[model samples]
Target: MINISYDIKEYRKQLFDIVNDGNVIVELGCHVGNTTKLILDKFDNVKIIAIDNSPEAVGKMEKLADDYSNLTFISGDVRRHEILLEAFRLTQSCDILSVDLGGGYHPDTVFKVFYIWSSTFKPVHSIIRNKGLVDFCNSAVVGCEDFKSHEGHLESYIDEGIPPQIKEFELWTPSLREK
Candidate 1:
């Protein structure tokens, strides 16, 4: 999932291209608020709940959140059930749910956690960090288009178009599933 063309600016543009006004964005791994800043800057009336494992990252986002009233920051590991529950309580459905949990875990493993947590409410679109995980997710949930950051680079995937909304969102807890 490494692409030389994967600059932060391009990443911001790609995210902005998919997200529009009034869309809720739940982002995993909000490192230093680079993407979070762009998201807030690009869209007005948008709600973004960004989470990161590091306190430093959250602190940085906290500084940025001061300027943008629509943004919220949560400091916790997204892989944790309680953290996911916190994110769920914040927003049930989002136009886009972007995830990049870093390289510590396998892409499949990361995708699985996100899938299980997000099973209740399907996002209108999703932006996954790895291409393989995107394929894996597409199998579990159909009709998402595979997109590349650059013309020939396939580091990520963007699930395009509108998806059906959920009436009752399902919430998962640690005891309910094996860790």
Candidate 2:
């Protein structure tokens, strides 16, 4: 049995509830198939496409794939828009897209990368053409003034001594879309 953390369980519930029956789900930065397993269990009919850049992570995902028939694991960088576009092309418009990328410190660089990658593919907006859902977790504004006070931690965003860029896109959230 998989040992799911409370935080991850909540995220899984959110994702599972949003996806329609038999819809497609794309999980970016799937590490070790933990969340992927949860998704598979929650939505048995849904097709899951999990992507991770690390070879080790991909190997782990492949091992888990043996038990789950609905899952397809791919090794690639989600930051590369072309790669993600190609992956999405293989399936129908996604009903749910979960982003768990930028797992490192150095919020400035990570935020910039996130913006670049997000702009390349508007997953939240694009996937929900006919009303879908996108769940973006563990994301923070890299060079924001507020983040500067944040301490450097493994999962927390680390603010380097860099000011925010003028052209930065404000981080997108479910609430933001409503208002």
Relative to the true structure, how large is the alpha-carbon lDDT of every model?
0.62, 0.51
Lowest summed lDDT over 10 consecutive residues: which window, candidate 1? 160-169
lDDT of 2 by residue, 1-179 (tens): 01111244555565555666586766666878887887677766978788888767967898887788888888887655455555646663454555555334244434444434333323331111110112122233346444321111111222221123423333332222243
Best by TM-score: 1
TM-score of 1: 0.66
lDDT of 1: 0.62
lDDT of 2: 0.51
Task: Give each model a TM-score.
Answer: 0.66, 0.54
Scored by lDDT, the top model is 1
lDDT tens digits, residue span 1-179, model 1: 21211234555556777788998888877878877887787678899998898867966888888888899888887766577768767776667777766535477566565554444335666665654554555567544776534321122322321122321223333332332
